[model samples]
Target: MLEGHALGVHGEGVSIAPVDFSLARGGRLTLLGETGSGKSLIAQAIMGTLPSGLAASGELTIEGQAYAAAEGATRRALWGRRLALLPQEPWHALDPTMASGAQVAESHRYLRGLGRRRAREAARRDLVGLGLGLADAEGSLPGELSGGMAQRVAFAAASAGGAPLVIADEPTKGLDAPRRDAVVRLLAATPQRGGALLTITHDIEVARRLGGEVILLRRGRVVERGPAERLLSAPRSDYAKRLLEAEPSRWPAPPPPPATCGEPVVEARGLAKWRGGRALFRDLALSLRPGEIVGVVGPSGCGKSTLGDLLLGLTGTDAGEVKRAAGHRLAFQKLYQDPPAAFSPHWSLARLLDDLVRRHRLDRTAIAPLMTRLGLDRELLARRPGEISGGELQRFAILRVLLMEPRFLFADEPTSRLDPITQRDTLALLVELARERHCAVMLVSHDPALIERLCDRRLVLGQGEAVLAPESLDAQAV
Candidate 1:
């Protein structure tokens, strides 16, 4: 259903090597690579949504319709009805002010030509099919949902128009193993219905599950492409081998139990929180000791993030008290799930860094070395938050927090957008620095393997029965 010859992305001083492929109906093609390696760029090129300053080159044929790949406009009208692009870290893709159901309904009403009543009903059914049938879910705004919840909502909205050919960019990010599998099933259904699918992902497991063609890329170049079964199981290229090795499941166990922890940096007792008329958590008790790495896990909207916010004092709790060790006011920091949300889109990263330094009286000398450690380019600092790739911006957010020498940090899916090798390396650097500075860390990730690999202990949330609730909270502190 989709065919491309020498498909590539081109821009000032950068370009993705030309690639050729044909995705027949009922076939799946996954683009796997490190962050900024141009996985998403290919999807964008096909969707005719390449960001400013970048252009697509080559020839593309979709559903027997041929067009110049560079003519982005030629495919514009097909965006919703024939082609759809599911964005990465989709919270930003959703409408913050609109109710979830309404957003989905909009696509059906306009793109699919459904009436208001029919569109609304269709949207409701879509949400329900995705397990978002809870009475309150359809009414909630993007801000009211968890990272995973927001991602599903975006998916519902994007696919509402019944687009046959789909481009999913990191569709399973910020979701637990079960949710990830569920989404993969959903993506698979498109091809089963005789539509073609092109997926962009960093997850080796996701590619294995998709079970079709796989293209491995690095630094805007294709290292290899072949059947998923062969490429992933017995990759020939060195980079491919390294990429597969970087999966959290293959990581070596962390060094013996975290160095004898120091005094508690923060403590929460009998903590409880309720959102949108549902109890998210109750009787949750945990403490963070200096230099201790704690991991958080659970299903989407299970209050993992709410718990972090409670500990960070970002929100008020109905029943709990949190005490923090006396230290610099800025010592407590959080690396947000949506890194772009944490920065000013209007200002350059350098300006934001400068502002933080001036506001906190932090030392500027540490910036260069920290940037190097985080694998960031000095030139990137001149771009605004909206200008860089999601993974790049996420790393920059980490750099900002590290500059303050935080005593306690809540990293909320900080590496969700990053590729395997980068994810492993970034986490390693974060662990090393946190240990050296004796900073407490509360890390949250959907991958159980990743948690088990780096955390001193794990806290699982959402194994309760209260209607999208955590009242009967199952607190397993492993």
Candidate 2:
């Protein structure tokens, strides 16, 4: 259904090397790579959505319709009818002002040619099929929904017309295990309906679940291509082998028990949070002790991030109290899940970082070494947040928070956008810094393996309450 020959994309003076591939009807192909490996660029090139000044080259054909670089009506006709895209960032893909259900209904109306009333009905059904409730899903706006919900809405919009080929860019990016499985099943079942699937992701596990062929890209070049099982088990390229080896794992030797934890630096008692008249959680209690890593984990939309916000005092609690040790209010720092949101769109990275450094009275010489350790280029400092990749932005966000040398740090899914190697490195750095500074770390994540490996203790939040799990219980939960 889709074919590309010598496909390449270029902006200014840089370009990804040309690549060739084909996906037959009902076929599945996964594109795997590290950040800036050109996987998304290739997908965008296929979808004919390359950013301005970045031109696509070579030939692309969708359903036997050929074009050098499809444009105008040729591209428009192919997009919604024959081909659909699940963007990497659902927030950007969705219309913020539109109701979630309305956006999906619009897709059904335009792509499937359904009447307004029928489209609304279909949209509700689609949302339900994706594990959302009809009443809640229909009433919520895109901004009101969580990351996982927004992704489902985007999926509903993309699949509404039953297009023959779908290109999904990190479809399971922010999802927890169960929701990730749902996406895997949704994409895997598409082939049975005569549609091909092309997935671009940093997750090898996702690729494994939707088994088919694997294409590994490195530095914008196709380094390896083969059956998913064979290549993953025994990759021919060293780079591919390293990528596979970076999957999270239990420590070979358990990390040295943390040094005697200090007194509680921040504590929350009888906390309650309500959104839109719905109680997200109540009577939640947790404490962070200096030099200890406390993990807050639960399924998506269970108020894990909300808990982070409450601790940071960014949001008001409906009821309850949050207490910080005397003189420590300014010592609280947060590493946000959505890195872009934490940064100013109008400011360059250099400006933002410099301002933070000034506020904290930090040594100016410390910046470069920190950036280098996080695998970020010194040159990136001059670029705006939007000008960098998500992985780069995530690293910058981590650096910004660490520079504060806070008494307590709240990290909300800090490495969610990173590749496996980068994730491991970033996590290690966070832990190392926490130990060195004797900082209390509150890590909020949906990643079981991560929580198991890094946290000294864990609080599992679900069904409107938080339960402190024993170490033995935590081991079995993963």
Candidate 3:
């Protein structure tokens, strides 16, 4: 059994209040809250890696081991064997300089005392068992792998430790429907494999799928705890009710119809990309009419985000011509999945947007309105990208693009980093702006619930080609 008794932690000028929760043998618990509610701090505290300047007073026990009583080396030794953690961002968890296989194999040596060859072989086998190809991926680095692939690799490594206590923090953040299901199913089976799981997430749907028990955290406090089904169907607490009500999946009405009588703002004929004898998105043709929102859904590494780059002229296409409507903005507005890496750290928010505005020669007077529409306050504009949350940067990126007033927009997993309330508001803002400007909106997302809310038509991609459905999206409500 894994348990946290009267856990309390704090840093210089920052306070982390005392919290209490527990997970029994083979039990599951989901920690839900808005960003910065101390979900991650709890995970780190259990893992014995609380950052410096942070003091902790807590009783964390795992099976027969007294985790709170152990010192530095003794605690470190227990990590991969007694307690394991799957962090939110796989890239941050992985060492980019090392090969994927080597990174995973290291855990085997540390936990099981296995030889190098045997450890790598074991890691390779686990990767294959997780539906990932071992031969091609084993030799690759995290930078070479896609977002979904990296997450899978990280999960594979974390699970390979075979720890009694497993902590997964938003394990399926950027994954698609099927991949997300696969990852969760894999983690759910961990209990039967003799591991207890503590999942930190804001997604109730994911929590329901990994059902065991639920613990709701709001503003650094435990507001509710019970069976997931009971809590989801009829929440007992007001905090839980507000959290569920704000979910975009619970929308009351369908989205408004796409604007009509508009020319195609962006068109691509036979778009293609080939590398290392692998062809991605061959003969991919797409036409985006002004004021229409086209949703792009596909598995990981299937070239959906790559298509976004081609649309923006960021990547070179092997064969095909892309044409835009006349007088269309030279630079397309885009919100990348990793917004922090997309910009320089030295530049403040204002400097970055101002430079882009000047470079694009966009309307200077629209700045205030643009920021206001994206729900950005004056204080945030003065902060650096490093100082803000992922959701804030994502919204700020959209605001920057809106300043250019591009005739066409491409957003790649824009809502993946945002919580439920912000996701709903952002979707609504995107819809309103597209209609008002008569811009073509190409939304690439893996969330079915999101596609149902914003898109007018669906474009599903598989086997390296996009398949367009003729049926209008008004009827695709769940």
lDDT on C-alpha atoms for all candidate structures: 0.86, 0.81, 0.76
Q: What residue pairs clash in candidate 3, if any at all?
A: none
Clash count, candidate 3: 0
Measured on C-alpha atoms, candidate 2 has an lDDT of 0.81
Measured with C-alpha atoms, the lDDT of residue 454 in candidate 2 is 80
Question: What clash pairs does model 2 have?
Answer: none
Cα-based TM-score, every candidate:
0.95, 0.92, 0.85
Best by lDDT: 1
Badly placed stretches (over 4 Å) of model 1 are: 464-478
Q: Given candidate 3, what's the lDDT at residue 374?
A: 71
Query: What tens-digit string does per-residue lDDT give for candidate 3 at 337-380?
Result: 76765767677798887887788777877878877877776666
By lDDT, the better pick of 1 and 2 is 1
What does candidate 2 score on TM?
0.92
* Candidate 1 C-alpha lDDT tens digits along 1-478: 8999999988855589899999998999999999888888888889887877788999999999998998988899999899999898666688888998899999999999999999999999988877775565799888888888888999989988878899999998888888889889999999999998899999889999999999899998889999999999999999999999999999996777555556789998888877767777787778788888888887787788888888888989899788888987898999999887788889989999999999989999999999999999898887888767888999999999999999999999999999999999999999999989999999999887888888887777774321221212334532
TM-score of 3: 0.85
Model 2 residue 197 lDDT score: 95
Evaluate candidate 3 by giving its C-alpha RMSD to the native, one decimal: 3.9
